[model samples]
Target: MHLVIVTAFDYPDGGPVAARHLALTAGLAQEGHRVSFVMLHQARPPAGARSNPAITWTSIARAGSTSPLAWRLTALRRLDRSIGSAAATGAVDAVLAAVRDPLLLEATLRAARRRGIPVLHELLEYPDVVRPPGPLGRVQEQVFVRRHLPAFDGVLVISGALEEYAARSGVARTALLGSIVDTALETPLDPLKLTTTFTVGYAGSLVQEKDGVLTLLRAAAAAAARLAPRYELRLEILGDTRPAAGLTATRESHRLGLDGRATFHGLVPHDQVRGILARCHLLALPRPVSRQASGGFPTKLGEYLATARPVLTTAVGEIPRHLRDGETCLMVAPNDEGALARALVGAASSYDAAREVGRRGRGLIDASFSAPVQARKVVGLVESLRGARP
Candidate 1:
């Protein structure tokens, strides 16, 4: 099947979103599906960006000197033209969009309707769940969720919570496509050797409310205190330090007396993350319990697991369903600094046992969450949608 994938992620080197799309599209291409990846917001490819010969990449640059509404309409017109051109050649089987804008979604539906093709939405998170919006944004999201979402021919959700939400929102066809990683790209770390410095690494947004970076910081401080004179604790954070609001991780680290021990590598390219993470003793995704946490799965978790590093994360969302507490990963309660600290200390103390658990977690990802595995589900969904199409 030939598929047109529309997304808002920056192409080639844009962080996790771009990585996720690239992995999925590469898998589709490997399955003999022609993929056209259309970037809705990126103007041009990044410097030193590499191309995939199997997939075609297109970018819809923002129009100059126009009102916000006019820009959206212009972008929609460009997208419509792209879709029509592909449909005219009988090359497009379906349109899979990972877009959040309601106007764009509406325009996509109208364009696909005209081209006699079905449109599928890749649902990652509810708009109002993870990031709370203003009043107008809230109203817009409500309209998008209740009205625009159900208009799609099918919806691909990333987590069980989102699948349920899609069903409740009246979506007829829904498929769960969780966080995907190309395990082939990952080289699991060899058995950990006893080291004086144990590093706990985290990648993703540093937002305290979203990723619980502050909690992780507090836990790291507590764990460091507990480790005392035996071992030195180091915290390595990757991603943006600026938060949407509240205390920044850097500031919190200083306040918690972890200024010397914590190192913040702000926003590196996705390709370099694995190499950096592999050097760490343990990886963490201490996401606190919230509506957003429940609704979405972290893409970084798959990447962390691929490194075969003991991942310490909370039992929230669909994670508990896939990973066993002591068997696969070290599970802890959300937002609990004490529990997180204890878990970190335990993992650091029992390095050999934790390495084995990390290996099992990696096995789980290889068996289930790998790019090829999830991409097959997408192919199946596209085929079913094509079959149902008149």
Candidate 2:
């Protein structure tokens, strides 16, 4: 099988899209499929991208692709050039778009349909509701949802929670694709076992409302002050934030005197994540975002589990259901600083038993979230979509 995956984010960012795409495509190719990526931007693939040995990348646009008139025109040209001799004419067995950018999804699907091929819309994020209909919103929710949802040979639902959302929204052929973890990138490690110097890590984006960066920062500051001598606590926030959204959070972090205690290793590469996890006693992400806090499985939870690092996340959303608490990963209430601090201590205090907990957590992932498992399930899910056309 030949596959094409479309995404809006820049490549190699190692966020959810990159992680799942890398794992699933590589696993599929390993299982005898040729895979190519069509990124909205020229997101250069990660350095060591060899899951199937036949995997490749083609850039459609860059970050500024969504810019105003000048850049949008340039982006379309770039898109033409990127796909001109290759993608536009390239022969692929199946073209799959697994993202939220409806325009790209529709354009690619329309092009693929012209060739009489299967177009699988791997639903990553629920249809973008933030943006209203007008210009391209002309694609009514029914038209967009029904247009894209039912047309695909299959639909890849990221989580059961997301599947339920789509089902309610009328995506008939959706399947719970869950998520995939690159075990190669995030192999299970011995849980950080130390009687001292307990470090909590948040190794992803820095979006304030969604990812709960502010909550994590304040909790870390409070934990730093509270858990200091007892646990030798430090917060290693390993990602970048949206300064353009206004640097209010950064200013608050500085104001709260988290400058030295909490190290912000802005945007570490994909491979380095596991290495950082080895140093982290517990992976901490207290997301307050409605989506995150409500229940959807944030991809980081999978990565943390894959690395055999005990996790510390909020008790919101489907997270409690997907990730077993106290067994697979620990949980704290969303944005509860005191509760978060207590979980940090409890995780560290129980560090002896917690080590096995981390190993078992990762073993559970190995049993479930490995690349091959996820890809095979994704293929079946897509195949099911092919059969269950409403």
Candidate 1 lDDT, 17-84, residue by residue in tens: 67788778777776777777676677665554345555776677573524657656667879888777
CA shift of 202, model 2, Å: 0.9
lDDT of each: 0.81, 0.67
Residue 346, model 1: lDDT of 97
Task: Return the clash pairs for model 1, or none.
Answer: none
- Tell me the spans in candidate 2 whose CA falls farther than 4 Å from its real position: 43-52, 59-93, 99-101, 129-143, 241-246, 292-295, 385-390
Question: Can you tell me which runs of candidate 1 are displaced by over 4 Å?
Answer: 13-15, 46-51, 62-71, 88-90, 130-132, 189-192, 244-247
What are the C-alpha RMSDs, in order, of all predicted structures?
A: 2.3, 3.9
